[model samples]
Target: MNIRFLAQSEYFNGLHLKDDIVLEKEYEQGPFTNLPKVRYFLYYLEENIRKEVMPYTDKVDIFNITDCQSESDYLYFIEYVDMLDRTYTFNIIRYNITDHTHTKIISLKDNLKLYPDNKQIKIFILDDSNLIIQRALPKVSENGKLKEFFDFSLILFNFVKNKQIIIEDENLTRNGIEFILPYSDNNCIMKTGYSLFQNNRHANLTKEEAAVESLFVVNISQFISDLQLEQPNLVMNAIDQSYYDTTVINAKLIENFLIYSKFNYENNDENIIFYDIETKEIYTCINKTTTGEYLLKNATVIEDTPYMIMKNSTGTQFFNLISNEIDATYPVEYNVRFVNNNTVISTIVEKNIFGKETEVVCIHKFPIKKVILQEKGEYIGCVTSDKETSYIFLK
Candidate 1:
C-alpha cells in the first residue's frame, strides 16, 4: 500500500508546540521564542513512547530539502527526507504555533547516500514541485569536449528567439550554450527536422532551398482567409465561377487578397458559394455526399432550338432533342424505336446556327427522372440514377 503524511507547524514566539503540547500564549512569546520548535516537538513525541517496549536511538539524519516552482504558478512544496535508518522507525509529526504551522516527516529505510562523487542527477524544478533523477554522465561537456573527441560539432537548426534550446553546465566554471529554434511570428513553432538544408548541417542546398521552405510552412487556411479578405472581388469571382482548379492560383494569391481585405471587413463571414459550369448549379454542400441544389431560375435555354427542356425540384435540368436527318432506310418504326431507346439525355446546351436544323445534344447519356418547372426557367433536379448527383462545394 502507498501512504503519505503531511504536517503543519505554527510559530508564535518560536517555541514550536506540537499538537499534544499545551502552552499559554504569554509563555510561548517569552521563554520559547528562541528554542528550536521542530526539534522540541519531535523530542516530546518520542518521550511519550514506552521505553521498555521500544528503544530509541539517536540515528535521525535530515537530508537536503529542495523547493521549486512550476511554470504556471509560484506555489512551492518543500521535501525533506531522513538519511539515517537504525533501530527505531520514525514518522511525520505536526506542530502548531499561534499563527503558522511546521511539519516534519519521518521514515524508516536503509542508509542512503545522495550526490555521490561522479554521480550525475537531473533536477527538474517547477513552480510548484521538483523532480530529481539519478542519471549516467552525459557524453558532451560544456567545454565542447565531445566535439573535440568526435571531430564534429552539434549545431541547432532553425534557431529563433523564445523557442531556444539551451545546454547548461552544473559548475560555474563551465559556460552554457543556447540555440534558438525557429518559430513563426504568430508564436507557432515549426516541427524540427523539416527542411534538409535548414535542419541538417551537412546538406548543401542552393537558391531554391529558401523558396521550398517558405512553401512548406505557408498556412493554407490563413493564406486563403487573407487573400479573400484583401482581393474580395477576385476571390468572389473565383468562387462564383469555381476557379479553384487553376494551377496559377496558389496560396500567395489568397494571402495577398486577405491582407488587403483585412482593413475593410475584418469581421466579415467566411462562408462562400461556388458555381461550376459543368454541373450548372451553385454548389453549397461539401464532403459526405456528392450532391447539391441548383436554382431553376439560373438555367438558360437557347431560342430557335430543337430541344425540349425539363426541370426538377432538387435543382437539376435535362434537355432532349431529336435528329432530323435520320437513317430512314432502317424502317420508320425501327428507327423510332431506336431513337426512343438510344437517345441521350443531359442538361448541357450547345448552339449552332450554321446547322440546317437547330441541333441540341445531351452531354450525359443518363435519362432525366425528375423535373421542376419554375416561373423563371426549368430546372432538372434528380437523375434516373445516382450518376447525376454531382458537384459539391464547401463553405
Candidate 2:
C-alpha cells in the first residue's frame, strides 16, 4: 500500500443547515417549515468557486437531492417532494458529465398512479435498467396507532421504458425492507428489518426475537412478469433464516461471496456471516469491535487474490475475501475509497501549521492488486455534498 498527497483534490463543504449564516440574504417569511435545500456549498480543485445548480424558487418550498450516484460518466439524482395532500412524489434526474449539455427528469407520479404517503423512501440503482425501491414502515405510537399507506410496496423498476413492478407483503405491514447482496447476474438479496424478527424454526417461541431478518432472492425478469401480467402471487425465493445473532444490518456481495452482518447501532458490535452463493457454504465471520454503517468495501484486490476492508473499534483492516482472513490494519479516523483502477482515495485529518486540524485527501496510484487487472487511464476528481452515494468523476 502507498499514499500520495493529492493537493489537487477537492473536499466537501457540506449542506446549508441554517438560514442566518448569511446575513445579506433575505427571505420572504413563510408559515411552514421545510427541509433545508442544497445551498451548493461545494469544493473545486482548479479555482475557488461556488456554484448552485437548482436554486430555490418562489413556488418550491424545498428542493432536495435525497440521493445521487455515478455510473460510468452519468450521474443519477433522486429528488423528493413533500405535498400538502399527504402524498409524496419522486423525480429521477439524470445528468451526463461527459456532455454536460443534457438533463432529463422522469417523474414517478406522471408514470404511475400510486403516490407514497412517506417521502422517506430508500432506493438502490442496480444498473441502467433496474432500480430497487422500498417504502419504510410507519412509526408505531405507544398506543399502537398505525398509520395508513396504500400498501407496503417494494418496487423493482426497469426505468428504461417506464416499466415497473411492485411487491407488497401485507402480513408484515410493520416490517421494512432493505437491499442486501446481488444474488445473481439479474437478481439481488433483500432483507426485512425495523421490528422484531421471528426465525421460522423459533416461530412457536412465545418470547421476543431479534430484528426480523427475512432473506429473499428475487428474480428480476419473473418479478416484472408477475406485476405486468397482474398475477396474484409474486415469485421469489424466501431463504430460511437462522438464529445467528440478531439481524443482518448490512451486506456486500462480490461475485459468489457475500458478507452479512448484524450490526447493533448503540453498542458498536456486529455479528457477521460469510456465505458462498455458488457452493452454499457458510463461514463464521469475526470482527474486532466493528462499529458503524455500511462502510465495508473491497479493500484493494491484488493480482487474482481479492481483499476487502473491514472495521474494528480503532480502525480498519484488509481482509482476504476468498481465504476469510485479516492481513493489515489501518489507523482510526480515516476512510479508504477505491476510486478505480487508476487511483485510490483516502481522507485523513492532520494538524496544520496554524495548530488547526485540516482534512487532507490522499490519492494513491493503482495496479496495487495483481489479482484483477483493469485498463489504466487519466483520472480527475471532484467532490459532492452527499457522501453516502455521491461520486464525482468530471473527466
Candidate 3:
C-alpha cells in the first residue's frame, strides 16, 4: 500500500487555516526558498525532503486556489474584491512562477443585469481558455433567521472568445470541488444524481432514500450568440427509474452520443449505457462478470478508439463493449496509453527506497491482447432520449 506522509505539523494544521480550500501542487520555486506567500504541501513521498519559508508577494485577497495537476508551472486562483459600493467584483488571477508575477486574466464586475450579491463562488478551469463559474447566494428563513441555504447556478465561460453561457434551474446543486471530465473540445457534460444533496447541501450525504439523477448536456458554442436558441437548447432530463436508484459514476459525450456507466445500489451492480442524442436511441453493454465494486474514479475515452479506458484498482483495464470483456491489465496507477486494442505503452514511475537511498525509474511495458469490436449491442434500450415522441405500448 502506498502511504502519503502529511506535511502538517503543529504549525499550520490549526483551526485558523481550516476554512480555505488550501490547494497545493507539486511545484518548486527557487529551491523552495524565496517563494511566494502561499501554503505549500508535498503529496506522495520521496527522498530529499526539503522545507523553506518565503514571503508571499502578490497583493490580493485569495479566496481560493485551484491547482491543475499538469505540467504547467503557473498557479490559478480566485479573488473577490470590494469596489467602494456594497457590490463586489470577482477576478481570476494567474500567477507565473518563472517571474514571480501575477495577472488578473478575467474580470467579472458587478452588473445589474447579472447576479450582484453572489456570496460564494467557485471557478473550475477545464483548460487555459474554458472555465465554469458557480455562484451561490443566501436565502432567508420564515423565522426571520438565516436558513443556511444558498441557491446555486453554473455559468460556462470561454475566455478564448469571451462567450458566457448561463445555467439557470430551480433544482440546481453543486459541489465546491468541481472538475470537468472532458469528452471533446467544446462539449462538456455535468450530472447530479439522486438523494437531493442531503438538506440542500453538498456535504453530509445520506443514503437509504433514492433520488433520480438528471443529466445535462451543454454545448458551449450553442449559447455563444442569441441566434442559437433553436439548437436543442440544452437537453435536460432524468434517466428512467424503471429498475432502482442509480448513481452516475461517469458520463461523457462520445461521437455526439452520451455514454455513461452508473452503479445500481439496490441490485449491487453496475451498467454502462449508450444514448444517442441526435437519433434518440440507446444501447447497453451487458457485462458477463459482476461489476460495481472496486470502481475507477477516472473515465477517459481515447481518441480513435472503440474501448473506454478505466483506472482499475488492481491495474489498468480496457472495458470493451463489443467483446463484453475487460482484457489486458497493466500495473496499477501507471501512466499508460494505448497503441492498439491489444498493446499499451506503460510509463511506470516507481521510487525505490533502499535504506537511506531512493532510486526512481520509469519503465515501459508492452502488454498486448487481441480483441475485436462487436457491432450489435448485447441489449438495446427501448428508452428514448426524445421524451415527447416516446410512446408507451400497452402489452
TM-scores for every candidate against the unseen true structure: 0.15, 0.51, 0.45
What is every candidate's alpha-carbon RMSD to the true fold? 32.2, 9.9, 15.0
Summarize candidate 1's per-residue lDDT along 1-395 as a digit string, tens digits. 11111122332221112222222222122112222112122222222321110112121222222212111111112222334443223332222333334333323232223222222222222111112211322233243322111111111111112121222212100211111111222211111111221122112322222111111122323423433233322121122111111101111111111100000012221212222222323322111211212222222222222222232343333332223221212111111110112232233223457754322222222243322211111212211111122211111
> For residues 174-222, what per-residue lDDT tens digits would candidate 3 score against the true structure?
3222333333455455454332323432222333222335565445454
The collision pairs in model 3 are 37-56
10 residues in a row with least lDDT, candidate 2: 16-25
lDDT score of residue 275 within candidate 2: 61
Candidate 3 deviant stretches above 4 angstroms = 1-76, 79-90, 94-120, 124-133, 137-150, 153-182, 192-212, 226-244, 250-260, 272-294, 297-319, 325-366, 369-395
Q: Name the candidate that leads on lDDT.
A: 2
- Compose the digit string of candidate 2's lDDT tens values, residues 1-395: 32222232333323322111100122344323443232222223224434443444222223222221212344455444656575546566554433443344455542122223344456666555666566653443333434432135567666787777765444233345544444554666656544222223223222242235567665655654565554544455565352334445556654455666655434556556666665766654444565344334443334434455666786656666677677555565655544433344555667768997655455534323222322122223433222222233321
What TM value does model 2 have? 0.51
Looking at candidate 3, the ten consecutive residues that score lowest on lDDT are 386-395
Give the best candidate by TM-score. 2
Off by over 4 Å in 1: 1-114, 120-122, 125-395
